[model samples]
Structures are given as C-alpha cells and as structure tokens.
Target: MTETLLVTGASGHLGRAVINDLLDAQKVAPANVIATTRNPENLADLAARGVIVRAADFDDPASLEKAFKGADRVLIVSTGELDLKSDRRLKQHQAAVAAAKATGVSHLLYTSMPNPEPVSPVLFAGDHYGTEQAIKASGIPYTIFRNGWYQENLFLALPHAIASGKWYSSAADGRIAHGARDDMAAAIAASLASGSKESHVYTLTGPQAYTTNEIAALVSEVTGKPLEVIQLPDEALTEGVKAAGLPEDFARIIVSFDANTRSGRIGMVTDAIETLSGRKPRTLKQFLEANKAALLG
Candidate 1:
C-alpha cells in the first residue's frame, strides 16, 4: 500500500532532507509524500517531481488541517522558536497534533530531544517535553525520535574558535553523542516508509560519543590548527559568547548545551539509528572531514 506521508516544515534543512531520502533513497513514491511549508514556492522542485506540496503554517490551524488531510503518517518537526518568553512554539506543536488527530492520521512521528527533563539547563527541553505529552494525550499511535545534537552544530562555534586557537566551554569533561542531522532525517524517512503500527521511542545518537576536549583534539588533527579547549565558569562562558557578538538567547543556548552535557543529560549513546535505518550513524570525524573547508574559514 502506498501511504501518504505529510512532513511539516518541509522547506527547512531536516524536513527537506527527509523528503529527499523518502523519495530518492527510501524509494517511497513521490506521489505518496506531502511537503508542507509556509511558502510552497520554496518546494517548487519537489512539486515538480510529483510530490504534493502544501502551504501549512504552524500558526494557522485550518491550514494544518487542510495540509494533513488524507495523510497516513505525519511528521511534526519541532518548531524553531527559542524565545523562552513566549509559548508560541508549544502552541504550534499543539496545533500540529490537533490537526493530525482531526485528520485521523495513522501514525505520527515527532522530532524530540534526548531526555527532555524539566530541570535540564537546555532551554528548549520543556518545549519538546510538552509536545511529547500532547502527542501521548492525542491517543495517536506514534514514534518519538529523541534526536541528539547535530554534529554540524559545531560550525556555529568552531570557525571562530579555530581562528582564536581556543575553544571555550563549561562542559567540564562532559561527552555528547552528536549525530548527523542527515542521518536522523534518513531514519525518520525509513520509519515513515515502513508504515508500521507499533509505537516506539528511539534515542538517536552518533555512532560514538566524544568529549569537548576530544572534539577539540579532532579539530586540531583535522585542520592542523592547535585548538585548545578552555574550560570556563558558566557565567564567564555566557559573557564570552555575548562579547563575541552572539545574541543573548543564542549565547544562553550554547552555554546550556554545555551545562546539560556536564549534567550527563546529552551523552546517551545508542544504536537506534542503525536499528531503524539499517545503517550505522555517521561519525563526528566523517562530518568534520566532509565540511573541513567550511570550518577552516
């Protein structure tokens, strides 16, 4: 049976990758996929390829209901709003869940965080937890993918650090199983294509875990740049990032990742990616090597 797969946030990085994996790699028929975004024009190529492209805004419930219609499985990619002052992201996720329920979607998949705890320093943890609760309460058979931090996220800080020959962090010997975003998207694409009825929770992490110091060493090896990991107090770390011209919200997010790592909340290593996608997850080394040119600049 060819089932319709509705992927929200389709214009974004993860969403586009999942759709591509579904159509090109997973061999899911393009006609069976629905790619929804705020601007359908962004997905014109997908539409040209026979994939159904729909306009669905997270803030627009009626559009979500329309876009989700007739979908067998739907993936509600978590919204990117990080302003803790507002509940917009949670409301958007809630809207997606409600739309899925109303459309009678067979199974729903949600991109979540690893160990979404209320007390965690990761500022976005609560938003993911709340979304998970809403999915459970929706009485929908679902797959919850607790995606680990993206190895590509290193680009946010690595270039600047390499230039200065120092990597600043407050993680204090903490490790992270940073998986590649594309690999997680592939896993999600595979799961959606399988059309299985079982409800499962997967903690998707990298093939191996690495500490901040270890990553710094790898950077030094990869780029021949003597990068030193500077351990700073949390307050000092935040101030440093802010002084480097990062917005306070983003600076706090970076610091919180370290704080969460120090607490051992982001270091859970798992084989869930291979179990789901029938392939080993990409290593941080592979990711770094592939993007070396970009990181060097």
Candidate 2:
C-alpha cells in the first residue's frame, strides 16, 4: 500500500503545481495523493485524473480533519486572508495545524515565507510565525519551508509599471532572492515525497539575489520596455498602489513587502531549492527571458 499524502489548498496555484509535480515528476500514484480545497468543484479536473479531491477549509476544522485523515504527510499551504484588523489568517493556519496533529499525520510540511521574524514589518509575518510556533508545539515531525518571494510576483507591479514607465517602490537598495513559483512547488513536492522522519527547516530561494534596479534592468532587457525603479516613501507608495485601483488593505500589504525589502529582510538567498529538487532553480534573468512576451504585453 502507498503512503497517502494530503495537500491543503489544492485549488491554488502553488498547491496545484505541487500536485502536478508529484504525479508527473515524482511519479507518485494519483490514488495516493489527496488534494484538499474549500471548493472541491474547482478541482474537478484533478479528481477526474485519479487524484483524490476533498474539501478542507482552513476555517473549518471538521473538514480539515476529514480531509487530512489517513495521510502519511500533510502540506499546509499558508492561507492568504490578509485582514490586519484581526488574526484571521493566523487562526486559520492554527486550525489546520491542530487538525493535522489530531488526525495522526506523521510528517507535516508548511509553505512559509523566508525569515518569518516575529517583529518583521510585513503584515503577513505574524501569520507564518504564529503557525510555525503552533506546528512546533504540536510535536508532529514537520518540515518548515521558508519559501522566498516568487519571481512571478513581479507581474503584480512590473507590468503596469512597464506600461507607465515608473515602478514605484520602497525597496531602496535591498536585494530579493525570488525563486520561481513552479520551482518552489517542485521542491516542496520532492520534500513531501522524501519520506524523511527527521524534522528539518529549509529556506528555499533563488540562486542569487538582485536589487529592484537590477530586476528592472532585466525586465527592460527582456521586454525591450525601458523601466526605472522609482523609490518612494512608504506612505506615498501605499497611496499610489491604492490610487491604481487596488483595495486599501491590499495596497498597504504590498507596500509592507517593499518596506520589509528595504529593511533587508527579503534578500536572503539559499540553495535549498536546488538541493531539495535536484535541479538548479531558475535565475531572475531566465524567468524574465522566458516570460518576455507576457511581460511585454
């Protein structure tokens, strides 16, 4: 009998990517994997492909326990609910951690941010840090993946900035090691399949770090669109992001990422991705060059 693996938030980008890697690259039998989401309908295609689909809402502990049952390992993809007024995300993460422990899951894994310091200025820092604490306290053998910023996150700001010729940010001279989302997903899948009983913490990151200006230059070179990093005060950057039609909360969150970057918190680099996946992660330029058409458009 194959050891079952439960993956939460399976409808999301990272979750779906990890499922694909597990099935295709790692050759994990589809019947051995359980893909959990709040809405199982969203994963109809995956279910049709022989992968088990279950509804597991982070906010719903019963569903999490049901979905997590019989799994040898579980990957808790951190929730994205960013309500600063309350500890909603952290609570949801804690619920999942609790469910994993209650269901007797042997090895637990989590996708967390790089350097999830308690005092970090980033708005989402507390969520990951709190979840990490809860996982440690649960006494389950766990692998905490301190994932870096995604190279693909550039799409959030860079495209519009390219169109307007100004990339507003508060990152200053700080560098960011941005691994591709697919690369990170593959690494996570590899670790989940490794069947290691020993607990480990891995900081997954790009091969190298690059400052905002350097990244802007790479974008310019790839898309043939001249772009410049326009550093702004944190307040001004937040306002500008909101002015561009983003929600006030989301805009503020984006600005916090930049502020964290400026504080030198997002610049950490590591070879964990390559070491775990057995493949060198894509460089920033490589990611940029491959997505040139989309970036240009």
| Candidate RMSDs in order | 0.8, 1.0
**Per-residue lDDT for 145-263 in model 2, tens only?**
99999989889987788999889889999989999999999999999988989999999999899889998888888888899889999999998988889999899889999988899
Report, for every candidate in turn, its global Cα lDDT versus the true structure.
0.92, 0.91
Instruction: List model 1 lDDT by residue over 73-156, tens digit each.
Output: 999999888887888999999999999999999999999999997898898899999999999999999999999999988888
- Give the TM-score (vs. native) of candidate 2: 0.98
**Residue pair clashes in candidate 2:** none
Residue 149 lDDT (model 2): 92
Error of 1 at 112 (Å): 0.4
In terms of lDDT, the poorest run of 10 residues in model 1 is 78-87
What RMSD does model 2 have? 1.0
Clashes (N, CA, C under 3 Å) per candidate: 0, 0
Q: Which 10 consecutive positions of candidate 2 have the poorest summed lDDT?
A: 288-297
